[model samples]
Target: MRNFIFILTKEIRSYFYSPVAFVVITIFSVLIGYYFYNIFAAFSTISFQAQTDPMVASQYGVLNVTEFVIRPFFGVVSIVMLIMLPMLTMRSFAEEKKTGTIELLLTYPVKDLELVLGKFAGCMGIFAIMLSLSVPCLLLVAFFGDPEWGVIVTGYGGLFLMGGAFISLGLFMSSLTENQIIAAVLSFASLMVLYMVGSSSGFVGEKMGQFLEYVSILSHFETFARGVLDTSDITYYLLFAVFFLFLSMHSLESKRWRA
Candidate 1:
Protein backbone atom coordinates (compact mmCIF):
# COMPACT_ATOMS: atom_id res chain seq x y z
CA MET A 1 0.00 0.00 0.00
CA ARG A 2 2.80 2.39 0.86
CA ASN A 3 4.67 1.51 -2.32
CA PHE A 4 1.51 2.00 -4.37
CA ILE A 5 1.05 5.46 -2.91
CA PHE A 6 4.62 6.31 -3.61
CA ILE A 7 4.38 5.34 -7.22
CA LEU A 8 1.01 7.03 -7.57
CA THR A 9 2.32 10.28 -6.18
CA LYS A 10 5.38 10.07 -8.37
CA GLU A 11 3.30 9.53 -11.48
CA ILE A 12 1.03 12.46 -10.67
CA ARG A 13 4.00 14.73 -10.06
CA SER A 14 5.53 13.59 -13.34
CA TYR A 15 2.44 14.78 -15.18
CA PHE A 16 2.59 18.27 -13.63
CA TYR A 17 6.35 18.54 -13.87
CA SER A 18 5.98 18.20 -17.61
CA PRO A 19 3.83 20.12 -20.11
CA VAL A 20 1.58 17.15 -20.88
CA ALA A 21 -0.97 17.84 -18.17
CA PHE A 22 -1.17 21.54 -18.93
CA VAL A 23 -1.59 21.02 -22.65
CA VAL A 24 -4.20 18.27 -22.27
CA ILE A 25 -6.23 20.19 -19.70
CA THR A 26 -6.15 23.40 -21.75
CA ILE A 27 -7.25 21.67 -24.95
CA PHE A 28 -9.91 19.68 -23.16
CA SER A 29 -11.31 22.74 -21.36
CA VAL A 30 -11.42 24.69 -24.63
CA LEU A 31 -13.13 21.88 -26.53
CA ILE A 32 -15.63 21.12 -23.79
CA GLY A 33 -16.45 24.80 -23.27
CA TYR A 34 -17.01 25.26 -27.01
CA TYR A 35 -19.34 22.26 -27.21
CA PHE A 36 -21.27 23.38 -24.14
CA TYR A 37 -21.78 26.81 -25.67
CA ASN A 38 -23.10 25.33 -28.90
CA ILE A 39 -25.39 22.89 -27.15
CA PHE A 40 -26.79 25.58 -24.86
CA ALA A 41 -27.20 27.95 -27.79
CA ALA A 42 -29.20 25.35 -29.69
CA PHE A 43 -31.35 24.67 -26.66
CA SER A 44 -32.04 28.41 -26.24
CA THR A 45 -33.04 28.75 -29.89
CA ILE A 46 -35.38 25.76 -29.64
CA SER A 47 -36.92 27.07 -26.44
CA PHE A 48 -37.47 30.46 -28.04
CA GLN A 49 -39.12 28.88 -31.09
CA ALA A 50 -41.34 26.77 -28.84
CA GLN A 51 -42.42 29.84 -26.90
CA THR A 52 -43.25 31.76 -30.10
CA ASP A 53 -45.12 29.04 -32.03
CA PRO A 54 -47.97 26.92 -30.71
CA MET A 55 -47.14 24.31 -33.34
CA VAL A 56 -43.53 24.18 -32.26
CA ALA A 57 -44.58 23.92 -28.60
CA SER A 58 -47.08 21.20 -29.44
CA GLN A 59 -44.57 19.27 -31.55
CA TYR A 60 -41.91 19.37 -28.86
CA GLY A 61 -44.18 19.37 -25.83
CA VAL A 62 -42.46 20.51 -22.65
CA LEU A 63 -38.70 20.72 -23.10
CA ASN A 64 -37.09 18.94 -20.20
CA VAL A 65 -33.79 20.65 -19.49
CA THR A 66 -32.27 17.30 -18.59
CA GLU A 67 -33.17 15.78 -21.95
CA PHE A 68 -32.63 18.79 -24.21
CA VAL A 69 -29.41 20.05 -22.67
CA ILE A 70 -27.75 17.96 -19.99
CA ARG A 71 -28.08 14.58 -21.66
CA PRO A 72 -26.72 15.80 -25.00
CA PHE A 73 -23.95 17.65 -23.19
CA PHE A 74 -22.89 14.45 -21.46
CA GLY A 75 -22.86 12.63 -24.80
CA VAL A 76 -20.66 15.29 -26.37
CA VAL A 77 -18.31 15.30 -23.36
CA SER A 78 -17.86 11.56 -23.72
CA ILE A 79 -16.88 12.02 -27.36
CA VAL A 80 -14.44 14.78 -26.43
CA MET A 81 -12.86 12.64 -23.72
CA LEU A 82 -12.53 9.85 -26.24
CA ILE A 83 -10.37 12.18 -28.32
CA MET A 84 -8.41 13.74 -25.44
CA LEU A 85 -7.60 10.85 -23.12
CA PRO A 86 -5.08 9.16 -25.40
CA MET A 87 -2.69 12.04 -24.95
CA LEU A 88 -2.73 11.42 -21.21
CA THR A 89 -2.07 7.67 -21.43
CA MET A 90 0.23 7.44 -24.45
CA ARG A 91 3.35 7.91 -22.35
CA SER A 92 2.42 5.76 -19.35
CA PHE A 93 4.75 2.94 -20.21
CA ALA A 94 6.07 3.99 -23.59
CA GLU A 95 8.19 6.79 -22.16
CA GLU A 96 9.59 4.58 -19.44
CA LYS A 97 10.57 1.96 -21.96
CA LYS A 98 11.95 4.52 -24.40
CA THR A 99 14.14 6.08 -21.74
CA GLY A 100 15.27 2.67 -20.38
CA THR A 101 13.65 3.53 -17.04
CA ILE A 102 11.42 0.48 -17.04
CA GLU A 103 14.41 -1.65 -16.07
CA LEU A 104 15.02 0.54 -13.04
CA LEU A 105 11.33 0.80 -12.28
CA LEU A 106 10.93 -2.95 -12.38
CA THR A 107 13.84 -3.36 -10.03
CA TYR A 108 12.06 -1.34 -7.36
CA PRO A 109 10.64 -3.31 -4.44
CA VAL A 110 7.07 -3.03 -5.70
CA LYS A 111 4.68 -5.67 -6.94
CA ASP A 112 3.56 -5.65 -10.59
CA LEU A 113 -0.06 -5.13 -9.60
CA GLU A 114 0.94 -2.22 -7.39
CA LEU A 115 2.84 -0.58 -10.20
CA VAL A 116 -0.05 -0.92 -12.62
CA LEU A 117 -2.57 0.23 -10.08
CA GLY A 118 -0.49 3.23 -9.12
CA LYS A 119 -0.16 4.37 -12.70
CA PHE A 120 -3.84 3.74 -13.33
CA ALA A 121 -4.74 5.71 -10.24
CA GLY A 122 -2.50 8.57 -11.29
CA CYS A 123 -4.12 8.80 -14.73
CA MET A 124 -7.54 8.55 -13.12
CA GLY A 125 -6.67 11.42 -10.77
CA ILE A 126 -5.96 13.61 -13.76
CA PHE A 127 -9.13 12.39 -15.47
CA ALA A 128 -11.14 13.31 -12.39
CA ILE A 129 -9.69 16.80 -12.51
CA MET A 130 -10.57 17.04 -16.19
CA LEU A 131 -14.11 15.80 -15.50
CA SER A 132 -14.60 18.55 -12.91
CA LEU A 133 -14.59 21.07 -15.74
CA SER A 134 -18.16 19.96 -16.41
CA VAL A 135 -19.29 21.14 -13.01
CA PRO A 136 -19.34 24.79 -14.05
CA CYS A 137 -21.30 23.93 -17.15
CA LEU A 138 -23.81 22.00 -15.08
CA LEU A 139 -24.01 24.87 -12.61
CA LEU A 140 -24.79 27.22 -15.47
CA VAL A 141 -27.65 24.97 -16.51
CA ALA A 142 -28.93 24.81 -12.94
CA PHE A 143 -28.85 28.57 -12.60
CA PHE A 144 -31.28 29.06 -15.50
CA GLY A 145 -33.22 25.77 -15.55
CA ASP A 146 -34.13 22.82 -13.41
CA PRO A 147 -32.05 19.86 -14.53
CA GLU A 148 -32.43 16.46 -12.91
CA TRP A 149 -29.68 16.05 -10.34
CA GLY A 150 -30.07 12.29 -10.38
CA VAL A 151 -29.40 12.12 -14.11
CA ILE A 152 -26.41 14.40 -13.80
CA VAL A 153 -24.87 12.24 -11.08
CA THR A 154 -25.42 9.01 -12.99
CA GLY A 155 -24.09 10.54 -16.22
CA TYR A 156 -20.89 11.63 -14.50
CA GLY A 157 -20.58 8.21 -12.88
CA GLY A 158 -20.77 6.59 -16.29
CA LEU A 159 -18.14 8.94 -17.65
CA PHE A 160 -15.77 8.11 -14.81
CA LEU A 161 -16.17 4.38 -15.46
CA MET A 162 -15.78 4.84 -19.19
CA GLY A 163 -12.65 6.89 -18.56
CA GLY A 164 -11.19 4.13 -16.42
CA ALA A 165 -11.76 1.70 -19.26
CA PHE A 166 -10.12 4.04 -21.77
CA ILE A 167 -7.06 4.68 -19.61
CA SER A 168 -6.54 1.01 -18.90
CA LEU A 169 -6.70 0.15 -22.58
CA GLY A 170 -4.29 3.00 -23.33
CA LEU A 171 -1.84 1.77 -20.68
CA PHE A 172 -1.88 -1.65 -22.30
CA MET A 173 -1.20 -0.08 -25.68
CA SER A 174 1.64 1.99 -24.24
CA SER A 175 3.17 -1.11 -22.68
CA LEU A 176 3.37 -2.71 -26.11
CA THR A 177 5.68 -0.11 -27.65
CA GLU A 178 8.51 2.31 -26.87
CA ASN A 179 7.17 5.05 -29.11
CA GLN A 180 4.56 7.39 -27.60
CA ILE A 181 3.15 8.27 -31.02
CA ILE A 182 2.46 4.63 -31.85
CA ALA A 183 0.94 4.09 -28.42
CA ALA A 184 -1.38 7.11 -28.81
CA VAL A 185 -2.43 6.04 -32.31
CA LEU A 186 -3.15 2.51 -31.17
CA SER A 187 -5.11 3.72 -28.16
CA PHE A 188 -7.25 6.07 -30.28
CA ALA A 189 -7.93 3.42 -32.90
CA SER A 190 -8.93 0.87 -30.31
CA LEU A 191 -11.18 3.35 -28.50
CA MET A 192 -12.79 4.51 -31.75
CA VAL A 193 -13.61 0.91 -32.72
CA LEU A 194 -15.07 0.21 -29.29
CA TYR A 195 -17.06 3.45 -29.39
CA MET A 196 -18.52 2.89 -32.90
CA VAL A 197 -18.89 -0.89 -33.02
CA GLY A 198 -22.56 -0.67 -32.09
CA SER A 199 -23.40 1.13 -35.31
CA SER A 200 -22.69 -2.00 -37.32
CA SER A 201 -25.04 -4.03 -35.17
CA GLY A 202 -28.03 -3.12 -37.34
CA PHE A 203 -26.49 -4.77 -40.41
CA VAL A 204 -25.86 -8.08 -38.69
CA GLY A 205 -28.04 -11.00 -37.59
CA GLU A 206 -29.87 -10.77 -34.31
CA LYS A 207 -27.44 -12.62 -32.02
CA MET A 208 -24.39 -11.06 -33.64
CA GLY A 209 -26.02 -7.67 -33.50
CA GLN A 210 -26.75 -8.11 -29.81
CA PHE A 211 -23.17 -9.16 -29.20
CA LEU A 212 -21.83 -6.18 -31.09
CA GLU A 213 -24.02 -3.79 -29.18
CA TYR A 214 -22.94 -5.33 -25.90
CA VAL A 215 -19.30 -4.92 -26.90
CA SER A 216 -19.77 -1.25 -27.65
CA ILE A 217 -18.78 1.17 -24.88
CA LEU A 218 -21.35 3.68 -26.17
CA SER A 219 -24.24 1.26 -25.70
CA HIS A 220 -23.59 0.90 -21.99
CA PHE A 221 -23.10 4.65 -21.65
CA GLU A 222 -26.49 5.39 -23.24
CA THR A 223 -28.33 3.83 -20.31
CA PHE A 224 -26.33 5.96 -17.87
CA ALA A 225 -26.98 9.10 -19.94
CA ARG A 226 -30.71 8.28 -19.70
CA GLY A 227 -30.39 8.30 -15.89
CA VAL A 228 -30.67 4.53 -15.66
CA LEU A 229 -28.19 2.93 -13.29
CA ASP A 230 -28.00 -0.68 -14.33
CA THR A 231 -25.62 -2.94 -12.43
CA SER A 232 -24.83 -4.75 -15.66
CA ASP A 233 -23.45 -1.58 -17.27
CA ILE A 234 -21.35 -0.84 -14.22
CA THR A 235 -19.99 -4.39 -14.19
CA TYR A 236 -19.10 -4.22 -17.87
CA TYR A 237 -17.00 -1.09 -17.34
CA LEU A 238 -15.28 -2.54 -14.27
CA LEU A 239 -14.40 -5.70 -16.13
CA PHE A 240 -13.27 -3.73 -19.15
CA ALA A 241 -10.86 -1.70 -17.05
CA VAL A 242 -9.65 -4.68 -15.01
CA PHE A 243 -9.01 -6.80 -18.11
CA PHE A 244 -6.72 -4.18 -19.65
CA LEU A 245 -4.92 -3.50 -16.39
CA PHE A 246 -4.27 -7.23 -16.14
CA LEU A 247 -2.81 -7.19 -19.63
CA SER A 248 -0.64 -4.19 -18.83
CA MET A 249 0.70 -5.83 -15.68
CA HIS A 250 1.61 -8.97 -17.56
CA SER A 251 3.19 -6.97 -20.35
CA LEU A 252 5.45 -5.38 -17.81
CA GLU A 253 6.07 -8.80 -16.23
CA SER A 254 7.10 -10.24 -19.57
CA LYS A 255 9.52 -7.39 -20.13
CA ARG A 256 10.83 -7.76 -16.62
CA TRP A 257 11.61 -11.39 -17.27
CA ARG A 258 13.32 -10.49 -20.54
CA ALA A 259 15.45 -7.91 -18.76
Candidate 2:
Protein backbone atom coordinates (compact mmCIF):
# COMPACT_ATOMS: atom_id res chain seq x y z
CA MET A 1 0.00 0.00 0.00
CA ARG A 2 2.82 2.38 0.87
CA ASN A 3 4.66 1.51 -2.32
CA PHE A 4 1.46 2.04 -4.30
CA ILE A 5 1.06 5.47 -2.76
CA PHE A 6 4.65 6.37 -3.60
CA ILE A 7 4.39 5.48 -7.27
CA LEU A 8 0.89 6.96 -7.60
CA THR A 9 2.00 10.29 -6.15
CA LYS A 10 5.14 10.36 -8.28
CA GLU A 11 3.28 9.66 -11.50
CA ILE A 12 0.56 12.21 -10.66
CA ARG A 13 3.22 14.86 -10.04
CA SER A 14 4.76 14.02 -13.39
CA TYR A 15 1.36 14.57 -15.03
CA PHE A 16 1.02 18.00 -13.39
CA TYR A 17 4.49 19.02 -14.49
CA SER A 18 3.95 17.70 -18.01
CA PRO A 19 2.00 19.20 -20.89
CA VAL A 20 0.10 16.05 -21.90
CA ALA A 21 -2.45 16.16 -19.10
CA PHE A 22 -2.94 19.90 -19.44
CA VAL A 23 -3.42 19.61 -23.19
CA VAL A 24 -6.01 16.87 -22.76
CA ILE A 25 -7.93 18.92 -20.18
CA THR A 26 -7.94 22.03 -22.37
CA ILE A 27 -9.10 20.13 -25.44
CA PHE A 28 -11.91 18.32 -23.62
CA SER A 29 -13.22 21.54 -22.09
CA VAL A 30 -13.39 23.30 -25.45
CA LEU A 31 -14.88 20.39 -27.39
CA ILE A 32 -17.57 19.50 -24.86
CA GLY A 33 -18.41 23.17 -24.40
CA TYR A 34 -18.89 23.52 -28.13
CA TYR A 35 -21.14 20.47 -28.22
CA PHE A 36 -23.25 21.75 -25.32
CA TYR A 37 -23.58 25.14 -27.05
CA ASN A 38 -24.91 23.45 -30.18
CA ILE A 39 -27.54 21.65 -28.12
CA PHE A 40 -28.68 24.97 -26.68
CA ALA A 41 -28.96 26.48 -30.18
CA ALA A 42 -31.00 23.58 -31.49
CA PHE A 43 -33.44 23.83 -28.62
CA SER A 44 -33.57 27.67 -28.71
CA THR A 45 -35.73 29.76 -26.29
CA ILE A 46 -38.34 27.04 -26.70
CA SER A 47 -37.75 24.39 -24.11
CA PHE A 48 -37.97 20.77 -25.24
CA GLN A 49 -41.75 21.18 -24.89
CA ALA A 50 -43.84 24.33 -24.68
CA GLN A 51 -43.44 25.13 -21.00
CA THR A 52 -46.59 27.09 -20.09
CA ASP A 53 -44.85 27.54 -16.76
CA PRO A 54 -41.43 26.45 -15.42
CA MET A 55 -43.03 23.95 -13.03
CA VAL A 56 -45.34 22.15 -15.47
CA ALA A 57 -44.20 19.53 -17.99
CA SER A 58 -45.57 19.97 -21.54
CA GLN A 59 -46.72 16.92 -23.53
CA TYR A 60 -45.41 18.13 -26.90
CA GLY A 61 -41.77 17.65 -27.96
CA VAL A 62 -38.98 16.14 -25.89
CA LEU A 63 -39.48 15.78 -22.18
CA ASN A 64 -35.89 16.87 -21.86
CA VAL A 65 -33.40 17.29 -24.70
CA THR A 66 -30.47 17.34 -22.29
CA GLU A 67 -30.18 13.58 -21.93
CA PHE A 68 -30.88 13.00 -25.61
CA VAL A 69 -28.25 15.48 -26.76
CA ILE A 70 -25.60 15.68 -24.04
CA ARG A 71 -25.47 12.05 -23.06
CA PRO A 72 -24.86 10.73 -26.56
CA PHE A 73 -22.85 13.82 -27.33
CA PHE A 74 -20.15 12.03 -25.35
CA GLY A 75 -19.84 9.50 -28.15
CA VAL A 76 -17.52 12.01 -29.76
CA VAL A 77 -15.96 12.79 -26.38
CA SER A 78 -15.29 9.09 -25.84
CA ILE A 79 -13.51 8.78 -29.18
CA VAL A 80 -11.53 11.89 -28.47
CA MET A 81 -10.44 10.36 -25.17
CA LEU A 82 -9.48 7.20 -27.03
CA ILE A 83 -7.01 9.30 -29.02
CA MET A 84 -5.81 11.45 -26.14
CA LEU A 85 -5.58 8.80 -23.40
CA PRO A 86 -3.16 6.68 -25.38
CA MET A 87 -0.82 9.61 -25.82
CA LEU A 88 -0.72 10.15 -22.05
CA THR A 89 -0.70 6.54 -20.87
CA MET A 90 1.65 5.41 -23.64
CA ARG A 91 4.55 7.05 -21.86
CA SER A 92 3.71 5.45 -18.52
CA PHE A 93 5.89 2.43 -19.10
CA ALA A 94 7.11 2.93 -22.65
CA GLU A 95 9.21 5.98 -21.88
CA GLU A 96 10.72 4.26 -18.87
CA LYS A 97 11.73 1.31 -21.01
CA LYS A 98 13.06 3.63 -23.74
CA THR A 99 15.30 5.41 -21.25
CA GLY A 100 16.31 2.17 -19.47
CA THR A 101 14.70 3.51 -16.30
CA ILE A 102 12.09 0.74 -16.03
CA GLU A 103 14.64 -1.70 -14.63
CA LEU A 104 15.64 0.77 -11.96
CA LEU A 105 12.04 1.48 -11.06
CA LEU A 106 11.29 -2.22 -10.87
CA THR A 107 14.18 -2.77 -8.49
CA TYR A 108 12.51 -0.69 -5.84
CA PRO A 109 11.08 -3.32 -3.39
CA VAL A 110 7.58 -2.91 -4.82
CA LYS A 111 5.13 -5.72 -5.57
CA ASP A 112 3.61 -6.01 -9.03
CA LEU A 113 0.15 -5.10 -7.71
CA GLU A 114 1.47 -1.90 -6.17
CA LEU A 115 3.11 -0.76 -9.39
CA VAL A 116 0.13 -1.61 -11.55
CA LEU A 117 -2.44 0.05 -9.29
CA GLY A 118 -0.25 3.13 -8.96
CA LYS A 119 0.00 3.56 -12.70
CA PHE A 120 -3.73 2.98 -13.18
CA ALA A 121 -4.64 5.37 -10.39
CA GLY A 122 -2.30 8.04 -11.74
CA CYS A 123 -3.84 7.85 -15.18
CA MET A 124 -7.35 7.88 -13.72
CA GLY A 125 -6.51 11.00 -11.73
CA ILE A 126 -5.48 12.74 -14.90
CA PHE A 127 -8.71 11.61 -16.54
CA ALA A 128 -10.75 12.97 -13.65
CA ILE A 129 -9.04 16.33 -13.96
CA MET A 130 -9.82 16.50 -17.66
CA LEU A 131 -13.46 15.46 -17.23
CA SER A 132 -14.08 17.90 -14.39
CA LEU A 133 -13.24 20.84 -16.61
CA SER A 134 -16.52 20.30 -18.46
CA VAL A 135 -18.62 20.98 -15.36
CA PRO A 136 -19.29 24.59 -16.28
CA CYS A 137 -20.89 23.66 -19.58
CA LEU A 138 -22.90 20.90 -17.92
CA LEU A 139 -24.26 23.49 -15.50
CA LEU A 140 -24.89 26.15 -18.14
CA VAL A 141 -27.37 23.94 -20.01
CA ALA A 142 -29.74 24.15 -17.04
CA PHE A 143 -29.89 27.92 -17.42
CA PHE A 144 -30.89 27.85 -21.12
CA GLY A 145 -33.32 24.92 -20.76
CA ASP A 146 -34.57 22.46 -18.21
CA PRO A 147 -31.95 19.72 -18.33
CA GLU A 148 -32.35 16.95 -15.78
CA TRP A 149 -29.68 17.21 -13.13
CA GLY A 150 -30.01 13.52 -12.28
CA VAL A 151 -29.51 12.57 -15.90
CA ILE A 152 -26.40 14.70 -16.22
CA VAL A 153 -24.94 13.16 -13.06
CA THR A 154 -25.44 9.61 -14.26
CA GLY A 155 -24.34 10.49 -17.78
CA TYR A 156 -21.11 12.06 -16.57
CA GLY A 157 -20.53 9.08 -14.32
CA GLY A 158 -20.68 6.85 -17.39
CA LEU A 159 -18.14 9.06 -19.12
CA PHE A 160 -15.82 8.64 -16.14
CA LEU A 161 -16.19 4.88 -16.31
CA MET A 162 -15.62 4.99 -20.06
CA GLY A 163 -12.45 7.01 -19.57
CA GLY A 164 -11.15 4.61 -16.92
CA ALA A 165 -11.68 1.64 -19.19
CA PHE A 166 -9.85 3.47 -22.01
CA ILE A 167 -7.00 4.40 -19.66
CA SER A 168 -6.49 0.82 -18.56
CA LEU A 169 -6.56 -0.43 -22.15
CA GLY A 170 -4.02 2.23 -23.18
CA LEU A 171 -1.79 1.34 -20.23
CA PHE A 172 -1.78 -2.32 -21.22
CA MET A 173 -0.95 -1.46 -24.84
CA SER A 174 1.73 0.98 -23.73
CA SER A 175 3.30 -1.86 -21.73
CA LEU A 176 3.70 -3.75 -25.01
CA THR A 177 6.15 -1.48 -26.87
CA GLU A 178 8.98 0.89 -26.20
CA ASN A 179 7.78 3.10 -29.05
CA GLN A 180 4.95 5.36 -27.95
CA ILE A 181 3.60 5.57 -31.52
CA ILE A 182 3.12 1.80 -31.74
CA ALA A 183 1.45 1.81 -28.35
CA ALA A 184 -0.83 4.67 -29.38
CA VAL A 185 -1.75 3.00 -32.64
CA LEU A 186 -2.46 -0.36 -31.05
CA SER A 187 -4.59 1.25 -28.36
CA PHE A 188 -6.47 3.46 -30.82
CA ALA A 189 -7.20 0.50 -33.10
CA SER A 190 -8.58 -1.48 -30.18
CA LEU A 191 -10.78 1.46 -29.18
CA MET A 192 -12.08 1.94 -32.70
CA VAL A 193 -13.10 -1.69 -32.86
CA LEU A 194 -14.93 -1.39 -29.55
CA TYR A 195 -16.65 1.79 -30.71
CA MET A 196 -17.87 0.19 -33.94
CA VAL A 197 -18.79 -3.19 -32.54
CA GLY A 198 -22.30 -2.09 -31.48
CA SER A 199 -23.22 -0.29 -34.72
CA SER A 200 -22.13 -3.24 -36.83
CA SER A 201 -24.37 -5.53 -34.80
CA GLY A 202 -27.39 -4.17 -36.62
CA PHE A 203 -26.06 -5.27 -40.02
CA VAL A 204 -25.47 -8.86 -38.98
CA GLY A 205 -28.19 -11.50 -38.78
CA GLU A 206 -30.16 -11.90 -35.54
CA LYS A 207 -28.15 -14.85 -34.30
CA MET A 208 -24.78 -13.07 -33.98
CA GLY A 209 -26.08 -9.53 -33.81
CA GLN A 210 -27.26 -9.82 -30.22
CA PHE A 211 -23.89 -11.13 -29.11
CA LEU A 212 -22.05 -8.37 -30.89
CA GLU A 213 -24.29 -5.74 -29.38
CA TYR A 214 -23.72 -7.22 -25.94
CA VAL A 215 -19.97 -6.82 -26.48
CA SER A 216 -20.15 -3.13 -27.30
CA ILE A 217 -19.44 -0.28 -24.89
CA LEU A 218 -22.29 1.66 -26.47
CA SER A 219 -24.83 -0.90 -25.38
CA HIS A 220 -24.19 -0.17 -21.73
CA PHE A 221 -24.15 3.62 -22.14
CA GLU A 222 -27.75 3.68 -23.41
CA THR A 223 -29.22 3.34 -19.92
CA PHE A 224 -27.54 6.50 -18.69
CA ALA A 225 -28.38 8.41 -21.85
CA ARG A 226 -32.04 7.69 -21.29
CA GLY A 227 -31.70 8.69 -17.61
CA VAL A 228 -32.28 5.17 -16.32
CA LEU A 229 -29.05 4.79 -14.31
CA ASP A 230 -29.36 1.04 -14.54
CA THR A 231 -27.24 -0.95 -12.17
CA SER A 232 -26.49 -3.44 -14.93
CA ASP A 233 -24.75 -0.77 -16.96
CA ILE A 234 -22.80 0.36 -13.93
CA THR A 235 -21.74 -3.18 -13.13
CA TYR A 236 -20.66 -3.88 -16.69
CA TYR A 237 -18.39 -0.85 -16.79
CA LEU A 238 -16.87 -1.70 -13.42
CA LEU A 239 -16.10 -5.23 -14.56
CA PHE A 240 -14.74 -3.99 -17.87
CA ALA A 241 -12.43 -1.51 -16.17
CA VAL A 242 -11.19 -4.23 -13.84
CA PHE A 243 -10.53 -6.62 -16.72
CA PHE A 244 -8.22 -4.18 -18.52
CA LEU A 245 -6.46 -3.18 -15.33
CA PHE A 246 -5.87 -6.83 -14.52
CA LEU A 247 -4.50 -7.38 -18.01
CA SER A 248 -2.11 -4.47 -17.56
CA MET A 249 -0.93 -5.88 -14.24
CA HIS A 250 -0.44 -9.31 -15.80
CA SER A 251 1.56 -7.83 -18.67
CA LEU A 252 3.96 -6.17 -16.25
CA GLU A 253 4.33 -9.39 -14.30
CA SER A 254 5.18 -11.29 -17.48
CA LYS A 255 8.00 -8.87 -18.30
CA ARG A 256 9.91 -9.91 -15.14
CA TRP A 257 11.29 -13.01 -16.92
CA ARG A 258 12.61 -11.10 -19.98
CA ALA A 259 16.24 -11.79 -20.90
Best by lDDT: 1
Query: Candidate 2 — which residues are off by over 4 angstroms?
Result: 45-60
TM-score of each model, paired residue for residue: 0.97, 0.88
Clashes of each: 0, 0
- Residue-by-residue lDDT tens digits, candidate 2, 1-259: 9999999999999987878778877887787778767766665545533565554344334555664567756666676677788877888888888999989988889888889889999999988888888777766766655777777778788888878888888888888889988998898889878878988887899978988887787667777766687887788788888898888788888977767
lDDT of 1 by residue, 33-137 (tens): 998999898888989999899998999888888999899889988998899999999999999999999889988888999999999999999999999977999
Q: What is the C-alpha lDDT of each candidate?
A: 0.93, 0.79
176 in model 1: Cα distance from truth in Å?
A: 0.6
Candidate 2 lDDT (Cα, 0 to 1):
0.79
